[model samples]
Target: MSRRARVLPGFSLSLGVAVLTLSLVVLLPLSALFFRTAELGWARFTQVVTSGWVAAAVRFTLGASLAAATLDVFIGLLIAWVLGRYTFPFARVLDAVIDLPFALPTAVTGIALSTLYADNGWIGGALADLGFRYPWPAWRGFDHGGWPIAWTVYDRIALAPLGVVLAMCFVGLPFVVRTLQPVIEDLSRDVEESAATLGAGRFRIFRSIVLPELAPALLTGFALALARGLGEYGSVIFISGNLPATEIASQVIVKMIEVNETGNYADATAVAVLLLGASFALLLVINLIQRAAVRRGAPG
Candidate 1:
């Protein structure tokens, strides 16, 4: 190829710059985190990571992020389809609104979510009422022998861990939405129509034709959202009520910074390493799953 036709000139210089940028922006910070963690030595590091508090935070953080990411894949695909496949009032506005989480400050998002979901707040009050409702009226003949059935919906929902999942869903949704939208928009209707003509149901056509095409994007989006949720702090802190049940790895680190004396972040670093390893393990699992999915879907 002629020099004029080249998209990027001087491959060596471009490669050098890219490597330099990656090292400075990513590697340096990660190295520092690892180095600080090493200062604690093996036994202390193990104790910090294996503590009850850390265990609870790990369980909640991992579980909530995984749930949030899984929910986002479905919800985001639906939203992407709606916005891309149909035209309606405020369509453009809705498209722009999808990026709000990215642009808005985390603190503001937390406060807003917390205010809306507090026990006395609008949505929270409704949930409390909904949860405590009776299944049948007292005047009704059967009425399960006059015993009032408590649904306990709010008890299951309004917990700190559930709140963490909610906050993660809000913050991480954009990743799934943005990742899948373009593919959804570009989807050709021919395969769908052919499947339909062959007597395939709407769900069947979607499953057999459309879903395989979307699987890679869905997995990628899920991975991104999962990573984002794992690292989330500000938005989660408020909405999750900072309780032990909802306490995340980030909160544990922050508390360690304050209570563990100045310049002493051994525990915090240990927690960071735990988080780093968990993120890597999760991502590796996602990658393996993605490859298997692609292979299964591939044509012989």
Candidate 2:
């Protein structure tokens, strides 16, 4: 039997440092939140969660985040393709621009989008010429009928739902592109060439080969974007009109703590816990899908 060597490097030391960092930075804060929330009895916590407005807000937040993440996935893929495949002039400029949302303050993004989508705003005027009306209710402060129904796309596209989505796409496009860009660049073009030689169409080659390879990364990007949009507050608040049932997950938690006297810290903590649970569940599902994809990719 071979004797164990003592020459191994500082793996234990590095791991200890990492654990300490995570505990101080992440676990401690999260534990505090849960501990504070525990002060709310189960009945109160249940009431906070099951409240009609809270329910609606949850639905809207999840729905908008999902829609935004989905849209980001496609646009991000396109951008990634352009960045990786085509070398147009100013490509580097475009590359840098994609990361702007990441660096820009969320409040700044909210203000900018609110201004752009306002009734008399420049972009809003053009869209209005195309027959767009404000989508939110008047109480929400956005002029209703801002965009015509055609521009609405989905039935719920109006309201802050769509605005939140737009903001999310702006912030999230980079993650998707960055995740998939390397994979796309390293992909073997010979597969496409060989498939084309076999009389397969471009769409067929992409459907059969490209998409499968991209699926894992696509799911990863989707998860990241969805998580981000779920937690997004500043960029969505102004554009979303801050209406009840239209506000996002994080916004609801903040409002409960800040606005309503009846809202206890426990209630705020409960809602946050719910959001965290949802995010955790989503990540688990995405990871499972990724693992399945990897298994499928393995040689039989």
| Strongest candidate by lDDT | 1
Residue pair clashes in candidate 2: 132-146, 132-147, 132-148, 133-145, 133-146, 133-147, 134-144, 134-145, 134-146
Best candidate, TM-score: 1
Candidates' TM-scores? 0.88, 0.87
Candidate 1 residue spans exceeding 4 A from truth: 1-4, 132-159, 298-300
Shift in Å, residue 21, candidate 2: 0.3
In the range 1-300, model 2's lDDT, one tens digit per residue, is 996766755779878999999999999989998888778878888898878677768877887788889998999999998998888999999998888888999999988987887656677657766775444321221235443222223233224466677887777778898898998888889988999999999899989999999999999999999888777888888887776646777887888788766665678899998888888899899999999998999897
Residue 225 alpha-carbon offset, candidate 1, angstroms? 1.0
In the range 206-297, model 1's lDDT, one tens digit per residue, is 88889989998899899999999999998988887777657889999999989845844878889988999988988898899999989997
- The root-mean-square deviation over C-alpha atoms between each candidate and the true structure, in angstroms, is 7.5, 5.6
Backbone clash pairs for candidate 1 read: none
